[model samples]
Target: MLKGRIIKALSGFYYVEHEGKLYETRARGKFRKTHETPLVGDIVSFQIENETGGYINEIHARKNSLMRPPVANIDQLLVTMSMKSPEFNYYLLDRFLAYGEAHDMEPVIVVTKTDLGNDVGKLEEIKNVYEGVYPIHFTDRNNINENLNDIFKDKLNVLSGQSGVGKSTLLNTLVPGLELHTAEISNALNRGKHTTRHVELVEVGGGFIADTPGFSTIEFSEIDKYNIKYCFPDFNAYSDDCKFRECSHINEPKCGVKSAVESGQLAKSRYDSYLAIHQEIDNRKERY
Candidate 1:
């Protein structure tokens, strides 16, 4: 038996890479009985049956996984967002950051299309809100952020964002000769067509990165209202000062987060996002 990491899964076969060699393998029938499907980025053990083919017999534990693109063991979530085309939405960006945090992946914000132009002071506003809170990069078609290139090293980074955010173009810029298919934004809907159909970890900067299909909506099914606040890193600084130790930071008296928001220490947009997401989770639970 040999151990390997699955790089790609297509047509009922998983392409596993072990020691610089890739072997086409299929999962054992037991996985079907267990209802556990093998996903890209899974570290698995398999037995070789032929020169190029094998059978995966076991799947190791994963740090985290996502079902939409069906990937596992991701270390970084590159929250790619566009500055213009579809327009940047702080709410959506916060959702991505919180989602990544809930799943134990480090979140890095990458704002694309700097050349597309925005209202005066838009860039500074973004920087003001997220600069000290997370690692963020601003890039355009002509110049990829230099700082962006260094974060991929030694991490299993996953690129994800809303459609028309230029995720594919950014990848092509970062990795020459990549030539990933990219589509123009549809003026009618103000969204880019989905181009990435499957997830495959491509080597970049001595690390692995996968480009996932862009999505507009994200669900917080795995996390609850009580725990969601922890996902917002900025809220951590003031959450402790709340009168209630188990403060939801909503409707709780002497709430430090609310105080920060009122005093202009924390962005109101961030507070609004927290309320929206908190209400969303509550509404979803009520429906169930």
Candidate 2:
């Protein structure tokens, strides 16, 4: 049996790369009995029955998994946003961060379209809110390569952001000949059309990137409330000091988090974002 990693899966066929060669393979019948579907980034054992195709025999364990893209073993999530055209939404960024934290993955924020008269002061405000906790990159033609090369090195990064934020354009610039589709933001609604319909892993700069479908919004109901605080890195220092061991950090008397917010130790905007997410989780609990 030959070993390979799956690069794409579509219509019951898996495209795997083995020893610089690509092969189209189908999973063995046992995988169906086991309810195992070969996903992108999965390492598998296969048998080449012919020159161009093979049969996937076994799949190794996964390090991580994402539902939307249905990929496995992601090392980092590159959350891309724009400075103006479509307007950057911090709430969306927070939701993505929460998702990353829930999955035990690292999240990095990338601000694009720096060449389009982006407000430096506004960008600074965002940086101030998240700088210490996550790595942030501002990219345009002048420094796009320099900035991205540093973060994407030796990691399986996913390029995710709202539509029309130039995600596909950025990928093309980084890895020429990628040939991914690019779409213009709707002039009427100022939103981007979905160009990537399916998830596929592409090799770039000695690393892999999973290009995912564009989304206007993300749901956080899948995450648990008890683990929400962990996603907000800035809240960590004061969370342990709450008077009650099970403090939710909202309306709890003598809560260290509240005190820190009152003392200006944390950005009010960040705190508000936390409260919003906490309330969302609380509301979801009522349903169950």
Candidate 3:
């Protein structure tokens, strides 16, 4: 058997990449019986039937995967958002960051439509909050490709963000001739319609990127109160100094996370997001 990674899934074919060559293959009948769908990022063992065809015999375990885009073994997430139209939001970005961390994928922030909004103060504020914690990039129509190669180099990156936030536009900019469809925000609904319909891993700049259909919101189905704290990268060092060993930082006295929030050591927005997500998790658990 030969080892290769599935780079794309179209119709019923799995385009596997091995040794700089793409082989067109398909899964066996047993995979369907087991209800196992081969995702774009799956590494599989296959047998080459001839010069151009084969069958996937086995699938390797994945490090992490996202449900919305349905990509697997992702190294990082390029969280793209717009500065206008849908409007720049810190809370939404926080959610993306925390969720990516929870799934063991690094998150990089990309702010799009910079020239449209002309909000310098807002941009600076976004940068200042996440300056040391995460890498952030800004782009406009004229120069959307700047500094993008370093962010996505040699990683399986999932490109995602809310609708009308320019996820497709930025992707097309990074990979010219992609020609991904873009939509304007609906004045009546105040959101953009989904432009991307399915997820397919496209290779560029020595990396694999899957552009997902833009979504308006995401829920924390997997996260719980106890584990959400680890999702915030900024709280790692200070969490040990808390009065309690397993501090949630909501009402716990002398909690290091809370102290940082009070002393301005941590961004108030981030702490608030943590609190909100924690509450949401608790609320969700209570409902079920």
Q: Which parts of model 1 are misplaced by more than 4 Å?
A: 118-120, 184-198
Q: Considering TM-score, where higher is better, how would the candidates rank from best to worst?
A: 3, 1, 2
lDDT of each: 0.86, 0.78, 0.80
Off by over 4 Å in 2: 141-145, 184-198, 213-216
Check candidate 1 and list the clashing pairs. none
Worst 10-residue lDDT window, candidate 3: 187-196
Report the lDDT tens digits of candidate 3 across residue range 60-145: 99998765566789998778778887788778888888878888889898888888857779988888889999988888767865
Candidate 1 similarity to native, TM-score: 0.91
lDDT of 1 by residue, 3-82 (tens): 99999887688999999999999999999999988889999999999987799999999999877667899999999888
Superposed Cα RMSD, model 1: 3.0
User: Can you give the TM-score per candidate against the true fold?
Assistant: 0.91, 0.86, 0.91
- The full ranking of all candidates by lDDT, starting with the best, is 1, 3, 2
Give me the displacement of residue 90 in model 2, in angstroms.
Answer: 2.0
Candidates 2 and 3, the one with greater TM-score: 3
Off by over 4 Å in 3: 184-198, 214-216
Candidate 1: residue 95 lDDT (0-100): 92
**Candidate 3 local accuracy as lDDT?**
0.80
